[model samples]
Target: MIVTAKQASSHCGGHPAMNSAKPTLPAQILSQTPSTSSITDRLWRHSLYNVLDQQPLDRVNVLGDNSHGHLSCVNTLSWTPDGQMLLSGGDDRTIWRMDPDYDVDYPFVCKSVIQTGHKANIFNAHLLPHSTRIVSVAGDNQVRVFEAAAALAHSQSEPETTYSIDQLDCRVLRCHTNRVKRIVTEDSPDLFLTVAEDGSVRQHDLRVSHTCGPGGSCPAPLIKCQHELSALALSPLSPYQFVVAGESPYGYLFDRRNTGRSFDEEWGSLPPTSGPSIATCVRRFGRKTKPRDDVYGTHITGARMSSHNGHEVLLSYSGDAVYLYSTRDNPQDEDEHHGSSIIPSSQEHRTDVIPIASDESHIDVQLAETNDNEASSPLQRATADQGDLDGSDSDDLTLDAMPWDDPSVPIILPRRRFAGAGNVETVKDVNFLGPEDEFVTSGSDDGNFFIWHKATGELHGIYEGDGSVVNVIEGHPFLPLIAISGIDSTVKLFAPVNHRSEFSRIDKQEDIIRSNSRGSGQLMTRGQLALIRAALSGQELSEGNPCNVQ
Candidate 1:
C-alpha cells in the first residue's frame, strides 16, 4: 500500500490508472479534481496525473540486490558534507551509498550495510561532520554509529562476487525507544543528534569514549531538552544554539555548552526520558504551548535557521505558509532589545488560505476545494509584515545559551523586499537545491518535479517524475547538472546545455530556449553497464542495478 500507482505502473505498461469508483482517482494521484459520476472516459482521467505531460526528465539509473523485494526506499536521504557521495536507507533495513559522479552502471557502490535490523526500513542516515563515521536511526527503535573507513577498507580489501552483510560493524545504539524518524548532526566534528517518532531529541557526545576502559561506559548526555518533537536544527549562526521545531507547541533552545555530562553505570537499562534539563527549562518557563494556526502550521516537514548572513538569522519552515523568521544583533545594550510577533497575522497571508480556528490548533486537514481552485505556477505577492518573528527571553538559561552572541538579539529588517513566490496549490515534498544557491527542487505526490530559482523564486523547470514520487534529486558536482531518485527504484542524471554561462554566440537563441524549456521527456539508461561493472570490477554495486530503467 505504501507504493504509489506511479511506482506500480512503471513495472506495468501504462500508469496504474485509477479505478475511480465514482471517477475517484486513488490516493496515489497528485493534484486531483473531485470526481462526479457523470464523468465517462476512464482513460482521459489519466491525463490529470500524466507526469510526462508536466515536467522535464532526461536519464535514469536502476537499483537491484538479492533483496526479496521486502526492502523499499524509506524516502529520506543525506549527503556527506563533502557532497561527493549520497546515502539512502529504506524500509528494507539497509543503508546505501551512491556516487553521482560515476556512470549509471556503476553510479553507486554499496558503501555500508546496517544490520541492526529494525522491523521497518531505515528512515534516515547522517554521515557525521568532519568525520567519516556514520550515524543513523531506523524504524527499528535504535540509533547506530558505523565505522565508515573500516567498511570501505574492508570492501576494498575483499575479492568476492559479493560482500557478506555479516562483515559490517553496525552498533545498535539504544538511545531513542521509538521509531528513529529523522536524524541531523552538528556541523561540528564531535557531536551527533537524533529525534524519534515519540518526539524527543537526544544528543550524543563522542569524546567520553576515549577516556573509558575495556569494561567501561561512555559519558551520559550533556543535556536533553525534552519536548514532544520531530525535527531540530543547530543554528547556522555563530551563537551555536540549537532548536527543535515540530508537533510540540513550543520549541526548545539548548546552549550546547550547558549540556555537560556525568557517567552512569545504569545507562544501559535507563529508559529514554526528557533529558536532565527538562525540569529546569519547564520549571522556569510555563507549561508547553501549541504551535501557530494552520496557515503557519502542519506537522512541519522541514525547518532551517538561515544565517543567510552572519548579521541576521531567518528561520524558514515549510508546512502551510512558507514562514521566514528574522533576528539581528543589538549593540546599544544586550537587554535593550525586543522581538516582533510569535502569532500569525491575517493581513500578510493570502485571504484564500483558510486559517485554522485559534482553539483548534492541531487537526489533520482534508481538503474541500478541488472544484474551482487551480494554479500551476508561482505568482509573486507583496507584503509589509516586516520583522515579524519569535524572540528569545533575555533571561538566565538563554544569555548563556550562546556566549558568542547575545541570546536576546533580534535581526533588523533589510529594505531588500521579498515578494511571496506562490506555491503548487498541492502537496509536494520540499527539497534543498545545492548550497551554492543554484536551484531548489520539490516533487508532488503525482510524480512531478519542479525546480525553482533561489532568489527570485522563478521556477527553472517542471518535469514528470517518471511514474513515482520524485523522492530525491541531486546535482552532479563535476558536470553541469542533476541526478534524480524516485519511489520506483530508478535513479537518473540531468543537465543544462542551454545555459548562457557556456556560450558566447546567440545562434538559434529562440529554438534553444524552447527545447530546454519544454522538450519531449526522454530517458537514457545504462543499467547493463552497471551490472557488468559490479560483476567484473567487484564494486559494491550488485548486478541488480540493471532493471527496466524507463
Candidate 2:
C-alpha cells in the first residue's frame, strides 16, 4: 500500500489509458459532481491537507546491539554539550555512548558502555548542560552519576572491547522509594532534581558522598505529592522553581526555597494546608475532569518550560495534542485572592472553560489574514477577558484550597491538520528546534518524526524514522543535526544536506527485514543488490530513503 514516487509515475504511464487494454475514457473524470464514497480515498485527501511541504530525513546510521547496541528499548537519548557525542539508556540496563565515525561509511559508531549502578530499566538520562558528568534515573529507585571523561580514560584502548560495569566511574544514590521517573538539572553539574513513582521529588548535592557506608548522608526530599509522578522539568530561569506532572489531573509547580522541614515532615506536608508556600502553582490542561476520572483524563507524557521564555509551559499529552499554558498573573489571580469564584462541590467546571475549537478557528482566520509572525496563540484568546497584570507576585499567590475554578486551563494548539501516520502510538516527548524555538518536533509511536510551525500551529513536516515506534527526537545542543531513536534500537541523525552527492541511498525495510523460506536477513540481500545494480545501469529507482518501511 505504500507507494514511492517512482512507482506512482511509472504506473500512471502519462495517462490512465496505459492500464486500459480497451483504451476507453473514464466517465467519472467528466462527471459534473464528484460522488466518491471510498473511505480510503477520503482518508488520503484528509492526510494531504495536514501534510506540510517539507524535506524528509535522510538515513544516517543505526546504532544498537546484541551485536549492534541495546537488545531492548532505547528509552532515552541525549547529546553532549560539545555535540560530538550522544548518550542513551533503556531497558538494556546499560548506558551507551555513540560518537561520530569519520572513517566508516556510517556516520556513527557505538562502543562505550556504562553497565553498572542501575539494576533495572532506565527511564531518563541527561548530560549536564556544560559538563562531562552524566546523570540517570531508573526503575531501581536509584539516581546515579557517571563521569564520562573518567570512563573514556580508564577504558581499554582496544576498539572492540566492550566497556562493562567494573569500568565505569559511577556514584550511586538511593533517593526514591519507587522507580525514579525523571531527572532535571540546573546550570551546575553538581546540582540536580529527581522525581519518582513514589511521588517524591528530591534535590541531590553531588559534592557530598551519596553512599551511606560512612560519612554519606541521604538528601532530603524537596516536594512530595499524593500520587505518582510521570514527568518533571526545572524552570529555565528560576533555579528554585520546577514543574511536576503525574497521574493527578493537575501539574503542580514547586519552589524549593519555601520548604524548611525535614524529609519525613515535608513528605507529609500537603499543599494549601502546610506547604502552600512551597507549592506555588497548580495548573490543568484542557477541561477539568471529575476527581474519579482524572486518572483517565489526558495523561501528560511530558511537561516542560520553554528554554527561551520561562513564562511559557509546554505540555504534551496522550490525547494526541500539545498545549501551551502561561503562568503570569491574570484577572483570575485576583478572583482567587478575593475568594469570589464559587466553590464547586465536586471540582467540575463548565465543559467549555477551555475553548480550544473556537480559539483554533480564530487563529486560522488570523493566519490567513495577516500571516504575521506575532500571531496571538489560543492561550491569549482564551485568557483575553481575564484582565492581565504585571507578573510581579505571580510566584507568591497560593490558594489555600484546590481552586473551584480549574487551577489553570490550556489554550489548545491545533495539531495533525494532516492525517496522522496512525493512532498506533502517542507522542511521548516534544522539543523546540533551532535557537529561536521556531519549530517544534516530536517522536510518534507510528515511526514518524513530526515537526510543527511554532507560531501558526501547522503540521510542518513528517520525517520518516525507524520502522517501529520512534520514542525520542532530540536536536543537537548547538548543531543543525537532529538525533532520532525508537523501536529499531538505532540512533539515527538527520542534518541538512549541503550537496546531492551526500545523499547515500538506503534500502527499504522490506529488503532489510525480508522473510523467506530460508528465514529473513537484512542489509542489501543479493536480490536487492542486483536491483541496485540494475538501477545504476539506467533503471528508474524509487524516491525517498529506501530504508523507510512506513
Best prediction by TM-score:
2
84: Cα error in model 2, Å: 1.8
Q: Which segments of candidate 1 are over 4 A away from where they belong?
A: 1-70, 100-106, 109-116, 130-132, 154-165, 187-190, 209-227, 235-239, 248-254, 257-297, 305-321, 326-431, 472-483, 498-550
Model 2 misplaced regions, further than 4 Å: 1-56, 101-106, 129-131, 153-160, 210-217, 260-279, 282-297, 329-347, 350-427, 498-550
Q: Pairing residues by index, what is the TM-score of model 2?
A: 0.61
Per-model lDDT: 0.38, 0.50
Model 1 TM-score, 2 decimals:
0.54
lDDT of 1 at 289: 15
**Per-residue lDDT of model 1, residues 188-258, tens digit only:** 66577776655556566765342222333433332332222455554444445554544322333445554
Assess the local accuracy of residue 218 in candidate 1 as a C-alpha lDDT between 0 and 100: 31
Model 2 agreement with the true structure over 1-550: per-residue lDDT tens digits: 0000000111111111111122111122112222334566334433322212233344444454345567677778877654455677888777766554322222444546776457888888877766667788888888877766654433223352355546556787875778998888887878888888776777777765544423334544665655567788776676666877754444555555655545653675322212322333433333222222212223456777666566556666553345555555242343322222222333333221111222322321111122243215432322221221122233322222222223343212111121122222433666677555566666655576666667655555566666677767777554445677777655666644322212222222222112110121111122223334544456643322110000
